[model samples]
Every structure is written in C-alpha cells, then in structure tokens.
Target: MNTVLVTGASAGFGEAICRKLIADGYKVIGAARREDKLKSLATELGDNFLPLQFDVTQKDAVDNILATLPIGFQQIDILINNAGLALGIEPAYEADYTDWETMVQTNIIGMMHLTRTILPGMVERNFGYIINLGSIAGTYPYRGGNVYGATKAFVKQFSANLRTDLFGKKIRVTNVEPGLCGGTEFSNVRFHGDNAKANDVYKNVQYITAEDIANTISWLVNTPPHMNVNSIEIMPIAQAPAGLNVSKEM
Candidate 1:
C-alpha cells in the first residue's frame, strides 16, 4: 500500500488531497495545527486517514509525530508540502514585517524541516515522491506578492535541488505551481479574515479549485517510476499575465 503524508491537511489543498487519495485507496496521514479539525477529519475519513495535529513551524513537534506514527501510517511514501499561507497583499515597503517572517517560517523553514526528516527513510527504502505546492506568484511577480512569491520561488528551486541530490534513486520530487485558485481559506487567511475583500478577489472569476490540485497530485503519484515530472505551472484560462506595468504621469 502507498502511504502518503500531507501537511496543512485541515483544509484547502491538503484536505482535498487527503480526501482524494483515500478515495483512490492510498493510506494517508494528515497533519495540521488545528487539532479539532484534524480529529473531525479522522472521524469522517475513518481508519485510512490518520489526523496528526502539530504546528509545522515547530521542529520538535514534527520530530515527535514522526517518531510515534502508528502502524499503517508510519512508512510514508509520498510527502506533500502544502501547509503554506500568504499573509497580506501589501507592497513590501508597506507590508507587515511580521507577516513576512511568518510566511518564511512556515513556507520555507517548516517545509524544509519536514522534508529533511522524511527523506532519509525514503532513501533507505529506495522509494518516495515529494510534491510541493508552489504558486505562479513565485514566477510572475505582482507588486504586493514580495515575500510570499519569494518563498514559493524557494520551493521551486529546492525541489529541483532535491531531485539532483537524490539522483540514481527511485525517489521523485515535483513542484506543483498553481495560479488564481479559489474555493478555500487561502484568500480569507491572506486577507486576515476579511471576507468581503477575499470575496472580491474571486468575484465571478473561474479559478482553479482544491480538487483540481488534488487530482494533479493523484496523477503525479500514479505515473510510472521511470518518469519524473520536475514541475507543473498551471493557471486558469480566465487568468493570464496583465502585461507590462506603466505609469503615464508618475
């Protein structure tokens, strides 16, 4: 049985991935900071889903959980680094420094720590796949996406570097970059719980959904071992580059 471990599993892409994978017959461990939500998911998903509650920012917590994983959930063959957030859309000069720091701690530090802890096992077993959730913000920069974009850019590069390090091994690493996705808490959290502002961003827009991402992940894992997909950058047809920025009277 293929066992997978997903971070940020309480909601959004992580929740969707867990739900989809379980339906496809993969055993899954869903880790998140929200204990209540995780437990609720456990109740809903039954024995195949193991809800792990711990803050990814806490290295010790990650270490503890991995050390105590139950029988079916212990050997994780796939790792999805999906527990990331964008705090605000403010420009760097006017953005919250605290928000930037939090983004780094979660998007970069937390993710890196978890991957490092899981990799050795994969190496020993000679089988593993890591799919990181990146954003198009990382490649196409918007004015206010400074730190969040940079963090995802890091994910892009890091996943490539990991594949380089694991060359000649059966392990695989892929970075899944998504653009303009809605139907989740991403915008709500990014806007700091301002539903109106969040709603406005997706008003009548046909953007990607959490299920779309989960389905992509499902395809990645099922691909043949001889093949490796380095990265996939996806944006809805309704979204595209805004072209050059200009100031006629600045």
Candidate 2:
C-alpha cells in the first residue's frame, strides 16, 4: 500500500481528500494545525489514517514532524500540498499588510519548504506524485484578489518549472486549479468569520465542493504511470472568467 501525505487536512478540501484516498485503499498522513479536528478524523478513519498535527506555516515544526514518520507510514509516494488560505478581500493598496504577509508565509513559503523536505525522498526512490492545489484566481484576477491570486499564480508556474527540472524519471508534478468552490472555510476565513457575508458568496449558486476536488485527485493518481497530467482547471457551470474591466470618465 502506498502512503500519501496531505497538508491542511483538518478541514475543507484537505479533509475530503483524506477520506476519499483512504476509501481508495491508501494509507494517508493528514497534517494540519488543529489537533482536535485531526483526532476526530482519525477516530472515524481508523488505522488507515494517520493524523499529523502541526502548522504548515512553521517550517521547523513541519520538518521535524515529517522527519520522524513511523515505520509503516514513512515512504510517502504521493504528496498533496493542500494547506493554503486567503485572508481579507480588500483591494491591494487597502489590504492589511499583515494579512498579505500571512498569505505569503502560508501559501508560498510553507508549501515550498515542505516540498523541499519531501522531494529528495521521492527522487531517491525514483517514484512520486506532487499535486498542488492552485486556484482560478491565479489565472484570472479580480478585485480584492490581489496577493492571494498572485501566490497561486506562483504555484502554477512553479509546478511547470518543477516538471521541466524533473524531465526524466517516474516522478510527476501537477497543478490542480479550481474556481468558485463552496462548503469550506475558504470564504469564512476571507470574511473573518462573517457567516452571513460568506454565505452570500455561494447563495443560490451551484459551486464546486471539496468532494469534487478529491475525485479529481483520485482520477489523476489512478492514471497509468506512463502518462502524466500537466495541469487541470475546473470551474462550475455558473462560473466563468469575465472580460477585462473598463472605466469611463466622469
């Protein structure tokens, strides 16, 4: 059985991915900061799921915990870099500097650090899959998306560059970008706990769900070893990138 390590597994897409992968018969190590939530998931998932508690934003903690994986779960054949977030939805100049900093630390720095730590093992074994959770915001920008979108764009390009560098060998790198997903803490975090405001973002719209993303991942990993999917972008029928904005003089 192959071992899979997923970050941001406490909730949202990360949580759903863990359940799906386990159901598909793979041992999963779910890493997130919320120990209580991870414990609950472990209870429900039984022995197949290993709950790892640590904030991905902290490189030291991430490195230390992963460095000491137990015997049966040590070799991670698939790594899902799903730990990321978006803060306040204010425009670039009006956005809080601290919020920008937090986004950079978690989305860019943390993901790279964790990947750096794990890539060597995958290379040595001559087999691995690295899937990054990017966003449509990266490909198409919108008001208030600012830094959050920028970080995802970075992810998109980074995945491409990684594939370029890993030209040969069995290792594969893919960037999964989704648009207008709901049923997660995404908007709630961006709105800073404003349930009403967050709810409004998805009200009456058939947005994507965490399960949808998990399904995509399951399919991606199940594909034949000879084929590698470079990138995939998904969006709900109700959502599509609009044309560029225009302004008129008063």
- Indicate the residue-level lDDT of 124 in model 2: 97
Q: Which stretches of candidate 2 lie over 4 Å from their true place?
A: none
RMSD of 2: 0.8
Give all candidates' CA lDDT scores.
0.94, 0.94
- In Å, residue 108's CA in model 1 sits off its true spot by 0.1
User: Model 1: per-residue lDDT, tens digit, 26-106?
Assistant: 999999999999999899998999999989999997898799998777898999999999999998899999999999999
TM-score of each: 0.98, 0.98
Query: For model 2, how does the per-residue alpha-carbon lDDT over 77-182 read when each residue is reduced to its tens digit?
Result: 9999999999999988899989999999999998898888889999999999999999998899999999999999999999999899888989999999999999
Can you tell me which runs of candidate 1 are displaced by over 4 Å?
A: none
